[model samples]
Target: MAGIGPLTQDWEPVVIRKKAPTAAAKKDEKAVNAARRMGADIDTIKKFNAATNKAASSSTSLNTKKLDDETENLTHERVPTELKKNIMQARMNKKLTQGQLAQMINEKPQIIQEYESGKAIPNQQIIVKLERALGVKLRGKK
Candidate 1:
């Protein structure tokens, strides 16, 4: 009789519960005020506002003006001659065939051969794209 009773023993499934917000969450009104001031178009404001109040308040501030100046300085530096040679060498070393390389970079096979042979100079934008695609730097006179 005892064994038969054990066969029907009740079992309950376990349920997981999430923690409730603390007291600090209840008094958090800054976000509400910000949304009100930003208006119903708050989503647009957030998207366009490059600089955020929270970001400005943080100690690690971004000096965008300084970044611009540094970028300008870097642009003026002359291209390293060795980098140009290496770019040409990399294509040859890969044994990709000029046509293959051209296809990979979305250019004509003759263009790839011309660049590799140093017969013509690629435009700045083309050089950048090629450098990234080939994983090699192609530096030349600025």
Candidate 2:
């Protein structure tokens, strides 16, 4: 649909008429008419809707904060000094500059420099990316 040509149809299709209002919708209309007859204020309806939305939003934020805390706790180990040294040595052995290594790993040159200089501690995901690109393990054997 995005990159192709327009379609040409051979024949026109038959049209269908709309169905009558459902029993649920008719019942809802009667309830609304009764509420109007009983004079339920519009301001009260607005306040109820606003309170419901606020409660839902607050709970969503709490769930998001819980997930963030969990991820932070999961990163237990920091990158070691030897890992930084290994990254720099591997880049040199591969005849690659920091920018070249960054390009290979889809990271910024500054980020690659920071990792090599021990200015940044990479997470496990980034460590795996570096290991794959450099063909060397930054993590030591157990």
Candidate 3:
């Protein structure tokens, strides 16, 4: 309802669908039918379906996943103390101020300061960004 468009248009008319498959899709359908006729079993069909669905879904999922992985703390976990020490040491070794390091990693200076002061532990992704920006390994690396 709140979008840049004609405010009163019926959505049904806006939704147009192709009744025919594209050439590539039609070729794929023929190949699948041929495989079926050649005695492709249920397991083979299932594998093909799974692979195709995964391929189709992955592209749309990438951007969403990138955003989620960057921002979401999936386990509600914090950076460990050892990692905090490493972050602070790394930032100091890099000869960068907290604000400068924050700018390098696209974070708030408060965030860098918090990590350095060990007052608040950052999320895993932020730890990774800091590690990369500061050229130091923080946590979970062998």
Q: For every model in order, what is the number of clashing pairs?
A: 0, 0, 0
Model 2 per-residue lDDT at 14: 89
Error of 1 at 58 (Å): 74
Q: List the residue pairs that clash in candidate 3.
A: none
- Number of the predicted model whose TM-score against the real structure is largest: 2
State the number of backbone clashes in model 2: 0
lDDT score for candidate 2 against the true structure? 0.81
Per-residue alpha-carbon lDDT of candidate 2 for residues 1-142, written as tens digits (9 for 90 to 100): 5899888987988889898868997897788888888998533243455545687888999999988778444553445788888998889999999999989989899988888777776677878898999998878861
Candidate achieving higher TM-score, 1 or 2 = 2
**Candidate ordering by lDDT (highest first):** 2, 3, 1
Best by lDDT: 2
Q: lDDT per residue, candidate 3, 1-142, as tens digits?
A: 6777865955665667877757997888788888889988633343455545677777889988888779645664455688778887887788889899999999899998888667774687887788788777787672
When superposed on Cα atoms, how far off is each prediction in RMSD?
A: 15.7, 12.2, 16.8
TM-score, every prediction: 0.36, 0.44, 0.42
Flag regions of model 2 displaced more than 4 Å: 1-78
| After superposition, candidate 3 runs with Cα above 4 Å error | 1-78
